[model samples]
Target: MPVFGIFVPPTIKRLRTSLYRDALPFSKNLRLKRRSDVDPMGREVSSEDSQRYCNVPNLIISGPPGCGKTTSVWALARDMLGVQIKDACLELNASDERGIDVVRDKIKQFAARKVTLPLGRHKIVILDEADSMTDGAQQALRRIMEVYSSTTRFAFACNQSDKIIEPLQSRCAIVRYGKLTDKEMLSRLLYVCSEEKVEYNNDGLEAILFTAQGDMRQALNNLQCTVAGYGKLSKEAVYKVCDEPHPEKLREMFELCVHGEVFQAFEIMNDLYRLGYSVDDLMSSMFKIVKQIDLPEAIRLEFIMEIGKCHALVLQGLATRVQLAGLVGRLCQTQSRLASD
Candidate 1:
């Protein structure tokens, strides 16, 4: 059962629209820019310049991890968009030293060195994590991208488009993706559950979703692992399998905080810390759980803000049970003030 064939993200339509826009007039525009030093080519061009001249503008798809950027790219290239992937595409990860060199050599060479292709086809080099390259490497890209504009196009996949240098960013058509909605994720999870014929309660599914945080790969992996170890999926089994703090306990902790029961909440927090979970795991899990806790909207926002601050501090290397206790104390204090008001 191959599922890749049917994979279409919610953003695929938008992607196709950006990717398939009319070819800009490359030669005519370059000819105009040629008289002045407007572009790297004697081609006077604005980074925001429009075209069908050299080729389609290179593509940059930005999104969070595991949101199907990779799948979407492959699907568009090999399945839906009729790209001859074997010949016309070169895929490389641009997150490490190897990528930098490739950016300098392989990508540059691939772009300049021409290959025969069907009419209207251009060679494509996909640079995953294009933003991770050093500033110097990216500067190199500015020239390489321009010089080879007529023969090849580069597709960049990055978690943050802002990290991409502006000149490169402007010459590219950008497509952004967001996390999958719970409804969308649940639908896919249900399909997986049915196809796998795994026994799972509703709570079991929810636990998977909670742990996955909208990542399909993580959700599927959690689902598979839960089934493999426990024989059936339950909320408890999922928590055990993922080794994440149980949401039930976290809910109880938050409930106590809302009731202004600081001592009891702190006790639960202490017990969780003693259970061998890292300080980061504790704060992160609580942060996620706090959002789902039934609380007054104002209280919810305050709680989130406080938890965010604690998480930030923890990330800066001050992780400790004392920090967690202090965060709990403040959360409880917030609830107390709300009650008094």
Candidate 2:
């Protein structure tokens, strides 16, 4: 446990334990791992407080969506402030319907002199999707940062830091977030499963990690989506109903279909369906495949059109398994579909 000297903002500190974890997009297992669990990656920044290092400090978190930028910031705040006034944690999504002026006004009110909370000496602002802000809005934001730096701290979160003005970038201690590793992601998911008393399959767990691509939130969300159908978790059950198909399994299935192993592909789809995979899940897998295959416009259009049909089926309440099986069957037959073109 090397110390990362980045001080947790007080607003995050004030979150109730339950709310903080619930707010996270990860599975129950991963959430549990956070309690008294150590970060094995040793990526913690153990220098001086982030405030001291970043002038007009703005943290630019770049990673895939669901990689925990927003949640991590909240966790940092919770650890710093204490679990009472997490509501004081003001968050504004620059991508939202509210314009920048409204956002600016909200910030002013939140940080106003009369708005004292029970915890922490100052206020914290989390500006989500900061890259979406217009140039005019950013100029206003720059002023806010300077005008209120004494009483407020800002945590700006975005998918890309390059969109931010360089002056703003220079002013903030940029903390680049990486994807959650398999071990860390698994540890969290397992902890949640234990609390929920879900029986899980080892293979299913491996599949989740492989497909999650270092995004803990997606891993957890997919897990929950799959398990919600059965109210119980098991590898076999997960495989059958899983909407987020494992990438490797999906690749294997595609190989079978493209190689004209119709029987084998059908068998795989059947196995997946029997294992509880939904039609929607299978369709989703096909979509991913189409995106990967380096096909000509004619082939791409044919595949996309077929995928669109399956997507429509999923929307029409077709059983998840049926939808998936149908997609695979159609993909296998698509050679003729293209030949007709």
Candidate 3:
């Protein structure tokens, strides 16, 4: 029978061997190509020395969504743990089964088994979205982790590490992943386009990055969506796929706000609402514009404060239209006061 929806052991073992042989070398080769003095967590690990510490540890990989936390874990498992070693791996999403029973039953059952691999290797249990687990569940998990430390290694992936119990945090090697830079995201997108043989414009790729805001996975997905919808990638095509307001429109809106054109700003806000942008989306776009524009520091600070208030209202369940209108009105008032002063 399947172990908590995981594949049957024999079938998984068979598939793992072939996949490990074929895919493991790719990661190994990629690592060899880079002469990085630091590992992914920003720790200094000489290329030669890194190879010596290839053994996987009980790790907690934390980062924003689409930032490659989970990807790094799989790479470590494949590259460091050897072929067919994943058969001894168990992947769980703590968000899906957050009850203490899962920790007491499913996790305990999986971790209790000895490694099927040779010596100097370990069984890996990857608990994704681990921050979502209840405190009670986390407490149970902490004890289980101690009990299985010798036989099973745990890799916890989460967007926020603070939500994970402190005891659990102390037991693992924490690896922090940051948002990908635009240059890094663009390079990866170009690689994908080349491999898929999809033609793309440079400006179109930049547009995708702007929409993704440092999310590598989101950038790639946006690229694919644009290509699928338009049969190629262009700036206009990407904007259409994302359904985001044109940069010119955003510029005009900000200009109106700065010039104290309250009515015009409200009109633009309404139009954006009609165009299917949510209040949160509008606020996010406005904040981005605020950072880029050349404005008096005082005015910029005031704008940010207003945006924060609007966001707080949004969180309190105020109507989107009301909050946005109030934000635009407040911006106009601030501009008027600054001008009069």
Query: Clash totals for all models, in order?
Result: 12, 28, 0
**How many angstroms is residue 43 displaced in model 1 relative to the true structure, after the best TM-score fit?**
34
Q: lDDT per residue, candidate 2, 167-197, as tens digits?
A: 6787687777777777788777787678666
Shift of residue 171 alpha carbon in model 1, Å: 0.9
Q: Which segments of candidate 2 are over 4 A away from where they belong? A: 1-46, 50-57, 83-88, 114-121, 244-341
What are the lDDT figures for the candidates, one per model? 0.75, 0.66, 0.77
Looking at candidate 2, the ten consecutive residues that score lowest on lDDT are 32-41
Best by TM-score: 3
Residue 219 alpha-carbon offset, candidate 2, angstroms: 1.5
- Assess the local accuracy of residue 304 in candidate 2 as a C-alpha lDDT between 0 and 100: 79
**217-241 per-residue lDDT for model 1 (tens digits):** 7887888778878988899999999
Each model's RMSD to truth, in Å?
13.0, 10.2, 7.2
**Order of quality (lDDT):** 3, 1, 2
Candidate number achieving the greatest lDDT relative to the actual structure: 3
